[model samples]
Target: MADIIESAGVVLAYGVAGFAVMALGYLALDLVTPRRLSSLIWTERNVGAAIVMSGQMIGVGLVVAAAINASEFQRGLGVGLVSTLIYGLAGVIVMTLVFALVGILTPGRMGATVLEDRDGRPHPAAWVQGAMYIATAVMLTAALS
Candidate 1:
């Protein structure tokens, strides 16, 4: 029980670290670009959204892989390699589903919003992302153990 608890904590910590790193990277890119992200994407909301979400997909996969590594010290390397690849593919599918759903729900908003929306709203895309996340987590857990 204690081992499981510790493992969970480690995984969560790794996810936080990954998220922080990814956010910082995005911020740096924004500073360097110095242009409206939408403009760069030809003002196509869907295209810009896809590009941003693609980064998010990679970031989420990295965090998931890191978390899996934290959970298994001995076999972390093997599991990390496998999970990273699986999560990368899963992220692409999940992000595509997310952007599509967002386009449906918000109509014109898609990638137009300048501010972030992190409210705990019941979104279909969130559920999809969560499902993919959990499934990948479980696969890594099983592979390690």
Candidate 2:
């Protein structure tokens, strides 16, 4: 019973820590982006922002999941936490680089392309960028896990 309780506490602690780490990843992405993502999504109701932000958050989550799956948290949750941070940050950084690379290859400026609209619709370039972000996450998660 005592061991079970201790294990439960560890899980809870790590779960919270994992979420905080993910939030930090989001902040990092927000800093890189030109527009305030929250304002664009909530205030402007920008579908482009919604898709891109959603992809970014999911990408970070996949990295955390991979870290948790790969690390032996039962041995030492502290070590597990550190591994999670390391792997998660790597995943975020890789995702960011993929986004930039895609944007560069894309005809127009990626940031501006994300905000571009045509005929009252979100531009196709934004969708492509979001897809690239998600695909990169999936690939990294597979390698990490």
Candidate 3:
């Protein structure tokens, strides 16, 4: 039916928007760290890097989902897509800022610390930084709702 097709189109649009936001998140994370993120995870097999990236991706997803849900209810499809993109980018920015702030307050650089591994195991800082990303996303979700 025409309605079904239209619904599918909306879904596609939203999907693209979410993907764009996630891509930005990845790029933001890549910028903060010293080594190339892809190399760190894929080539080096860095557990710490993997954990940090996973946390960022998950956090971005949460914020994107919340933005989409809230925007869809309050506005139409177009506005929803735009808002989702905006909110998702905001989430990325906030997460990056938090990372930087923590880096400043902590004894060592947060990004470098999280990427460190010992005997193939991730550093404790990795877990803490990862949680920070998720926690920041949770706060953003609350703000969106």
Candidate 4:
């Protein structure tokens, strides 16, 4: 039916918008961290970096998911997309601030704590930071809900 096709188009548009926002969130994260995430995780085989990256990805995903689900798209596709973008950007900013503040509060340099590889052995702090990021995302999403 034409209605079904139109609905599908709307869904597709929403998905595209969400993913674009998520990519921007990742870029913001890349800017905040000292090391490049893709290299640290893929090339270096750094478990600690991977852990932190995982948390960040999930956190950003949560924000994107929340925005897509909660936005005023039902009012109209354009309105919904714009609202979702606004929410997603806000989430990214908030998460970045959380990361930065926590990084500062932690005892050592942020990069050192996150990319802790000594003789290829990972440090405990890396995991702790990862969990904190996840917790921040969870709390943020819940608050937004």
- lDDT (10s digit) by residue, model 3, range 1-145: 9999988998899999999999999999999998999999999999999998999999999999998987753567878888889888999999999989989999888889999988999999899889999999999999998
Give the clashing residue pairs of candidate 2, or none.
none
Candidate 1 local lDDT, 1-145, one digit each (tens): 9999987875665566455544543443344333554454445433333345445545455545544454443665445544544543444344445544654676344333422223523334434433443454355445434
Error of 3 at 136 (Å): 0.7
Question: Poorest 10 consecutive residues of model 3 by lDDT?
Answer: 70-79
Global lDDT for candidate 3? 0.92
The estimated TM-scores of all candidates read 0.35, 0.88, 0.95, 0.88
TM-score, structure 2 vs. true: 0.88
Name the top lDDT candidate: 3
Question: How does candidate 2 score on lDDT?
Answer: 0.79
Candidate 1 structure lDDT? 0.46
Q: Write the per-residue lDDT of candidate 4 for residues 5-106, one digit (tens) a residue.
A: 999998899889878877887787778778897898799898878877777778878877888788897798999999888888888788788878887888
Model 3: residues with Cα > 4 Å off, grouped in runs? 72-75
Residue pairs clashing in model 4 are none
The lDDT values for all models are 0.46, 0.79, 0.92, 0.80
Q: Residue 76 deviation, candidate 3, in Å?
A: 3.3
Minimal lDDT window, size 10, model 4: 125-134
**Tens-digit per-residue lDDT, 40-111, candidate 2:** 888888888677878888878877888888876767888888887778878888888887888778787787
